[model samples]
Target: MIAIQALRAYNLFYFSLLSVFISFLPVYLSYRAVSPSDIGLLVGIGSFIGILSQPFWGMISDRRKTIKKVILLTLGLSLLVGFVLFQSSELWLLFLLVGGMYFFMLPTDPLTESLNYRVAEQYGIHFGSVRTFGAIGFASASLIIGFTVDQIGMDRLYWVFAVYGVLTYLMCLVIPDAPVSSKRLSAADLRRFLTYPATLRFFLLILLAAIPHRTNDSFLGVYVQSLGGSTGLIGLAWFVAATSEIAFFALLPRFLRTGREIKMIALASAIYVIRYALCAVVSDPMLVIAIQLMHGITFVTFYTASIQYLYRIIPEEWKATGQTVLAVIFFGISGIIGSFAGGWVFQEWGGAALYLMMAGIALLAFLYSILMWKREEREAETLAGEA
Candidate 1:
């Protein structure tokens, strides 16, 4: 049977390709001697546009209930955007290109997840198994792109990114369009979307948590390079990280229990305390690279828990909006801010500052979690009284 599993496999194929681009982009831009602020600006613009586009697209997806077309259209737009990036040297042009890519690429994650969930609901296929494909792809791409950056020049890497963008667009063709909803999101629906104050709080909580959570994502490759590490080594580090993420995801579904997500996230943030501190103090290439195992928690744990939280807390109509909120606040905007901040801190306070700042941010997240738990208890009591 042609199954959604096919799309799961494709998700791996496409995102693994993306992992390479992601793993290398910061390092590449930094190597070109791009000013950190400009690098931030470029990344920031893309993120801003991505932040805006996801909700809009999700709304459209919810309203129309047709996911396939949105997926295909976005893939095409991003492919064009990727090629346009190849033509840019002017700052604004690059800004525009990145924004355009953000527009097209942002929806890939949410909509793809939606698709996977629907399929898993219909079929017995586990989501993690599908997700494992993405991890494998990420691990594999890390090796290729990592070695390529070392063997070839970074300048030629845009071509790789551009070509893959095109290839990803093509992948959209084989996968069926996501089932779209024909029902328009109504006033009541909007109200329902907003009624979950706890949900909104959770979104904000993750957003705050995401700021420093992603500093590593935004800077680690370059950080590795700065420590006199090779691109290949950087790639291998990410490869190992992604691989661990895969293993974590493999075992994740079985571990879902009450209060586990909260602990998982809190633990991940705590790990960052040591993870970044290690990055700051340890100069040894081997030891520094070993810290990447922390990525398993930071990205996979934090993300899976956060996304699952959205899936549970968000009303069906506002699902996309809710997911987009997390993306916009934490990954998109906060990520941009963190990148600039990390680069500046690295330049100013040195690498130690970057890690210290992350440690500080993480501690703040830990406090937020405590407060969130209190809020949850109050809400639970209110529900019980109502019952």
Candidate 2:
């Protein structure tokens, strides 16, 4: 039997393989002659569908208490989509596949993350260290595959994603044999989790943050390549970002390391304003890459805080469900709107304007987060008075 630690690490590694492949999906469509707006539609519609699916999947997982079935079923569906991509190269098919792939893939991370937290709680190991390895994998893939595409050409792209899917299916087999939660949350608890005002605010925070990040995700490839960048530099850029993320994680156990969850999210939101703005105006490749380095503060810091906050705030029965809600709101819905906005912004308004717009989003998020924090404080005082 693999130690739970090893299992957790493997989980992150395999997931990274998938992330690397998926991250470049926008670039892939662009190469295939897909229009930016249509590309946005593809990403957006797929995300919307996936967002809708998340609640259902979460409910299914809640009822089942083990997302094993959800994972297997979704992965199996993903495999079919990957296979179809090879069979048909039509533009419509390409658009359809993007959505199909995302629908199946969105659940993997949030659900697996919930599982990782559970494993860490069960065994005496630092979840951050174990999970940080996944960031390593994500960074490695971004660099490696970006280089590979530059050298070999873009034809190998789908094969890469499909191969990753096959390997991920195999990796899913090794998730440490943890028992499912038999103690389900009651209807009242479930309702409470759904009705929590913080839940709605958190979802909005994800929307605002994701809107800006989508510009980076959707256009960074073309932006770099047009600026005399080779694939090597693109990979290095992502590597730098991931490297920053790793550094942040290391420091996380100390600074803002305590359950100061709201603070971390607020800080990340603030940093994103600066990060994307630099992305727009920096003329030097090195400077652009430097901005990528802030990915550490933007993602790893924000994500860790988010997981902890959601875990603490939601009902136990809705642990996976709550996490899934986060993904659906941020990745699925927000990504869609952002991608569409990004396409227009990149084409008409230009990267600099797009980055500026994204900066504005970060500002909005900061204000919203402050309001939320204050709301929580006031609510606490009210409850105390009643007691």
Candidate 3:
């Protein structure tokens, strides 16, 4: 019971810290007079660093057989680097700081989720029940910080971020460590894991589906501002989107069974098609916020299903590394492409055109999902035949 409470508490503060970075970092850069394209490049560079660093940290956790230690180390580094990052106004210095911060910051996401999943399964707790606190934290933080930034100015973003960071660290100290894998993992073992046909296909699908989602994450606040919305409205926009996820996540474990994960992902991808299409043409910022209600449906459905399917296919011994691979592709590679291209499109053609391009990409993901669904069905049939 104590461990469960610890997990929930840690998630709440961790995601509140995350919301500050994810929801407002780009807006902060804009406020600092950095151009959109430059902001994209900086974010892309950070994503690239995440790609290089996430797997290294994951492998270290697997080798050491400890998630908690790795998380603590990274969180400490992130806090140190983030303090410097927010203090800098120079473009070149900010560039270096962003990379340093992201290198230690991004890996913690998958590591924490891996910890959350493992602890939940060990204790017979529904994962979503524990994970719901993260959504609540994100929604609440987005609303509060948006208003706070309006009052205190974006320069003070670091103080809000630091408070949540410290809270997360303190909570992490009380949570129990996850059950460790007993088998020793080798480089050859990791190579073999990546070579699985299913692994390749699954990662490709994640990359395709995640690109537009990540792009929106990188730019929606900026887009809202471009349409003449204030900082408070940006917070409200995220609040509406994130608050909707609370109900969906709470209900998910009941409806989201094992084999149904991929189909759920497909359904979410199909919805992304429509959501991005609407975002492409909407002129009113309030309408954009209204459309964000779909975020509850699309994001929770896509993220939960994808992670569940990943766990099903991965080997138990490589759980941390497998989750890291998922994070690299979803947040790292997808983030690179999304940040770079989104920045370019926003700089050159405008947000509407950028969103139109996203709609087209979502359409492709929907079609690709149909193919994956067929593949899953065929594989299931073959297994049943053998049985």
lDDT of all predictions? 0.72, 0.73, 0.91
lDDT against true structure, model 1: 0.72
lDDT of 1 by residue, 304-357 (tens): 777776677666666655666667776687867787777778777666668778
lDDT string, candidate 2, 1-387, tens digits: 266756655665565566554556666666677776776777777777778877778777888778766787887787778666634457888777777777776776677777677777778655676677677777777777777877866667666667667777777776764346667567788677767776777777878877777657766766776567776777778777776776777777676545477778888999988888777788777678778978888887778888888877777667777878888876777777887788777778766787788899888988888887787778879999999
Ranking by TM-score: 3, 2, 1
Residue pairs that clash (backbone atoms under 3 angstroms), model 2: 245-296
Error of 1 at 203 (Å): 1.6
Off by over 4 Å in 1: 86-88, 180-184, 258-260, 377-387
Candidate 1 collision pairs: 64-181, 65-180, 65-181, 66-180, 68-177, 68-178
Which window of ten consecutive residues has the lowest lDDT sum in model 2?
Answer: 14-23
Instruction: Give the higher-lDDT candidate: 2 or 3.
Output: 3
> On residues 1-387, what C-alpha lDDT tens digit does candidate 3 reach at each position?
988998999999898888888898888899999998999999999999999999999999998999999999999899889877876789999999999978999999999999999999999988888889999999999999999999998888889888888998898888888888888777777787799888888888899988999999999999999999999999999988889889998988887998898788889999998998998899999999999988988888988898899888877889999999999999999999999999999999999998899988888888988898999899899999999
TM-score of each: 0.90, 0.91, 0.98
